[model samples]
Target: MVSTQLDAHEGSGQNSESEKPTHVETEHAAVTYQEKNAFQAHADESGEGQNTKMTKRRFMALVSQAFLWTGSQIPVYLFGGVPPYIYADIGGHDRWTWFVLANLLSLAAVCPFVGSLSDMFGRRYVALSGASFIVLGMIVCSTAHTMNVFIGGMVLAGVGAGINELTALAATSEMAPTAQRGKYVSILIFTIVPFCPSVLWAQLIAAHSTWRYIGLFCALWAFVGLVLTALFYFPPPRVNSEGLTRGEILKRIDFVGGFLSISGMILFMAGLQWGGYMYSWKSAHVLVPLILGAALVVLFVIWEGFFAPYPMFPRRINQAPRILTLTLIITFISGANFFSILMFWPTQAFNVYGHDPVQVGIRGIPVGFSIMAGACIVLWLLSVFRGANRSLMVISSILMTAGCGAMSVARPDNMSTLWGILVLAGLGIGGIVVPASIITTIICPDDLIATIAALTLSIRVIGGSIGYTIYYNVLVAKFTSAAIHYIGGAMVKYGNITSTEVIGEVIGLTSISLLDEIAEVPGIAGNEALYKIVIQAGQIAYAEAYKWVYYVSIAFGAVSVLASLFLGDIASYITFPKYQHDSQEFERWRGVRMSCEHSLAEIITENN
Candidate 1:
């Protein structure tokens, strides 16, 4: 049934006698023709054709890929929690945001190209290259003496992360049956369970030892994954590149589209990251790149839709347009929500709830555990309730919305309430990415899986970039205003500090980095009572500012919930054997394994 639907779509333009096809359809049909011929040619050349079967070698490869994914994620989760220590050591307090931006910008910008290259080349070499970058970046970062050097290292690491993330996901999905894609992907996620406390690890290492060791730790682990990948992962050559010469393959790449997409994403995200934080929203620094980048993005889409011979986002996947589009939307919103928590939860813990680094790290564990649990639950549920994609997404989104919305009431005094809300939100985060990737790979053609998967990952990062910008601006603006009001009022009323200039100077020191300096502000010096009042007021102001950020997040969560509602049913697509030959081969492998187990049981019975 799945094959028939695909065949019908593929043949629509050629067989339709009643009406002429539109230009878009006609172009897609031509591309489809070339893809089919290339696949056939590759199959012919490979000769020893059997469906995708799980051998010991292949199983080991999957395990290696999972480790690579975990290694890549370590740096990402690690960096968010230790920026304070990094900045203190490197002296880039004012430019600290660049630490994250550098990694994210490079990751988002390079993802699509990585996908295209993986498809043009093969997964093994491309993935190995990515692992190499991670090692090199980690070395640079661990030894960095300046902020510029550290940021550069982050850029290299981001590029490596993009490649490893996309390739691992695509490679894993392609290896599994469609019916079990969710299960296999979930298993891959399970590898990260032990490492989910990476933020805690960062805190502990930074507190007890040098923070630079965190980079060394990640570098060492990534090196292990790199060596494993080189030894184990050997995917079949891509269908598109099987018959092409090096020059021909290079020429086939859409350089124009790649340039437009990469440049546009970098410029657009740079503008968003810089606005209101580094410069005013209306300033040319923000507006010029934002507008120009948006225009280029639009142009890139237009070029992909109409002009590019080999587009990064191939038109063939449009057969399931509604499902594809909605999944991307949910993935985007989920990313935004996830990053908001990952980036800010530690801040909230340290500022409002926890007293020390260890307490803050302990507080963060529940959310990480919940996220992994949520993902594992959804993946298992997907297997049991086949084609429950829409239902699962809806539930996940609602959970996220409820948790994020309720978090607005969190206060410095209510530690228990905060933990519960964090768990709720974390579960929602886990349910999104794996399921979305499964649905997307299910709908897309086998050859284009990497391309579509890369797009989803890229969109998620882009969403994070946008979400971070909005939340950052909101939090900073609200915190600054509330701090002036609360702290200044306390200084004047309780401390009896009347001079506006003196109050202003003291209030300015109420920032996260400068909070300790408040007592050193001449008039406040040696006055322990005034210091306590000022600190109390600042905490109250922080609580109030954070509430707005959570409230704003509720809207994004709600958007995801609404989007999930429109996803088309994918029950038949996943359950029905799409690749007949592969299904037959898998069944044979299952029988052999069962027979081997039975024979072993009989031998044990005879011995008894």
Candidate 2:
């Protein structure tokens, strides 16, 4: 019979093979055994488990979770492409950054807490609550009349998104065997295939109907998810919370840690978002929050590491500290790289490539397809190579780095090559994201999967926030200087308009939102030749600015590559013991199984 014990390193951080347990007695393992016996008894009574097919109820549960996952992703994919229309309708040209920042900050802030709550309370209600929040937030967003009100709605939706995202990942991961966890997660992600064109959908909707309808549609989708979750998606009770009373459970929650983590993330990201955009980096408005938030975050880490009884990041993760730490680092850099593309690709398409909304959306389709394809490729590679995670990650990071570096060559003349470049980058993103997450679950104890997953996601978002700020500042600074030089010089040479004040006014109106208004400028009006020259100069200036962004991005990609190189081996963790039971017992146990073809107990069963 195959060994039923996990590696000693996974259990007690021991290097001695003799120290490993004969039948791992971890809480999660115990729970799996109990679940196995229960499933077996049920299957015996029903004469089921005759084949290796998933049950209808379990399939529906997976489908329901998929819907929730798609709903959560809508805001992420939609907002990036539709923000221009949102700003136009809501009149928040000056405060537009807040629209994106609000959602991101809230989503990042609540993730750790959501993981804790899901682990402590159970998955069903927490997930349902998230769907409900999405519904309410979308309704508010759809009906909002002002930017502030809309931002408020986004804050609500962001919280729900965080909760739902973590819950779905944890729920789905638990249902699959360790050996095939990555594959199952990839399948879950496949549910978003319909929304791959979400960027285009947002643009098309704005052109045909109202931007508010986007909110209405999201709300409707979330409502369906909420109903499905309410009807299905039930899993077994959490072992951690089985015997705890209501009051006891409340006492067990680390409210102090939650407060510190949430507030620290919000303030830190808020400060970053505002710095150099709304306020100077040195201003007290930015420094105060940045300093205070950093201190609080440090304190929260200390609390979780030393004081909290039920820490969000459990100590078990320390067993494979090197792998865990490296995985998170890779995850962080990947987020930075991914968001850089998501936020700026459209800008490049509009200003440099000179595409209309529809065309821009169509161009973005390659990115979505490439990301999904990359993820699928990684899953297949993992299975074929039996989880050569470190090698795969290094390769993916290299692909991403090459793709990002290649983007420096993007120009209006070579628009054809941009599609292939984007596909390469998208594939890297898909490869890195799913595997980094799966690795986290592999190294840690099964019970802490939700917490670890949440922490990984939170880190990624934080990295993205910082990356976005850096790229934005770089683009603005470079673009402003380049635009003045190119557009101003062209106006003087071509248009023979040399008045500095008039030049300044014309250039100021050259922003993407106000680009058309440049034709209406006092000196430039009725001067078609001058207008064409200025437009060309502006496009060249945008290309220059975007090139600098991609160049800086290469440095980040290099960091990801270095981090991936140091990731410790996770091969042993991915292997599972074969089921040693007779065919009759296996048939009886299979009927009630919900997760996948094999239950955790069956995967690790030892012959008596």
Candidate 3:
């Protein structure tokens, strides 16, 4: 392996043979600069090439984009940590489902359209608009006096997040050199690095100050993002080949399809969330929306396939059957496992262990850091190998499977063991995102980068919403039945002076804080042994219920591993079109020697 560089004199067609690009002879192949056109050669000379250092101008542009990136992602993980305050200040637990669903539904609805619009118009304006929406939403949330207003604010915020998130990723991919794209995108993972800290921060602020101040801080953060985007961020210019006008662009909006998809997703998710908690599966409250949502999904597919002038998701990319299939599969499974763990593990810490918000947040630091570390690991691997990411995917899924399986057996006595399991699961979850993003970037045409990125992200969000709903239901059912069984059995066997109704009432409430309060009631307060029995029963119930959800996650992880095997090798697909380099053919020939049956070390040795 050798480092190679090309100057304008080498390939701009302005010099004689002596000025041609140099090549380095290697054991397998000669490494050389590849120029697709004279225009690119000139562009490379202007310091835009992979080997050239980025200009100060371009570095500042990335910094500006990073501000927007942070503001957009703050709303995502912040809510996961501070839901208690949200429910208390805005709505009760009964309305908690709406708060979560509002942003997700709006995000799912808007992402495809936002990506398409950015491609149609420009990234800078779209990003500015996204930042503006976030600011407005945060303000509304901060000032809201009613649950309805708060939900509305969340929906707006979700729309902004949807636009900014995908646009930032696309811009990063387009700006960075092919070899360094993974490195740059890995930086985006920092947006969620506050997952644990945000919980602690929000709790600290809420405890000493007001929860509303947190919203104000985010609003101001987005305001700064808005200013930075306006002053600095600008993407390369593009125009439609057909010379489409404003009206023409509007005609290609695919409003009907977007509406159907968004509405369908919201309805289905709402149904799932309400079914076991607020309403029974047989109730019309759940069934009506679910059936309607399913119908709309069918309509969405039909419209995209046959009716839309320009589909939200391009059909051409779907032609790459294996890559498309694997991308969705891995993203979907990982999304489910990722969300279930993030949303539930904290609940376990609070409920079974009687930890406060700060303690719960502290307990989550291992998982949060592990996620960032996992993403960094993949970036390093991609940089070193230049592209064989299939192994990383397989390894990540295996770890996730093992981690979740381990979690299913966690007992209250050994709850500390969750740290190890969470680390493995977080690593697996974070590792999975990179290969899928890289594969999508490599397989699709340069023009469709944003559109494809948005499509893939939307799929992950939808998968997460589905996962959250499923796990919420699973948690409720398991906790309710288990709690009833343990408490009722204890009451019957040791029919003491304590009221069974009081125990049942306490079990009905889901908040962890209530469990602590229940132990100090007048009747049980004087009886140390009875209080111990009650607390022990509550811990066992919550922990056992949590284990069931973990088991389900294990199943998702196992399926992800099997799906990853069919992802093909990433090395074969990676190509730097801007540099006119393609390794597809060479990778094919090389595959014959690096067979799957051999040890990984043997394969690496043979490749070297």
Stretches of candidate 2 exceeding 4 Å from the true structure: 1-62, 115-122, 169-186, 232-242, 499-502, 575-608
**TM-scores for every candidate against the unseen true structure:** 0.81, 0.84, 0.81
Deviation (Å) of 405 in candidate 1: 1.4
Q: What are the runs in model 1 whose C-alpha is more than 4 Å off?
A: 1-66, 119-122, 169-187, 230-240, 498-509, 517-519, 575-608
lDDT per residue as tens, model 2, 53-109: 467766677777787888887875776777667776776766666666678778877
lDDT (tens digit, per residue) of candidate 3 on 457-571: 7777788789888888888889888988776555444546456676666565444335445555555666677666766677788888888888888778878898888776655
User: Number of the top candidate by TM-score?
Assistant: 2
User: What is candidate 1's TM-score against the reference?
Assistant: 0.81
TM-score, prediction 2: 0.84
Model 3 pairs whose backbones collide: none
C-alpha lDDT score of every prediction, in listed order: 0.70, 0.71, 0.64
Give me the runs in candidate 3 sitting further than 4 Å from their true place. Answer: 1-42, 45-60, 119-121, 170-196, 234-241, 382-389, 487-500, 510-536, 575-608
Report the C-alpha displacement of residue 383, candidate 3, in angstroms: 5.1
Q: TM-score: which is higher, 2 or 3?
A: 2
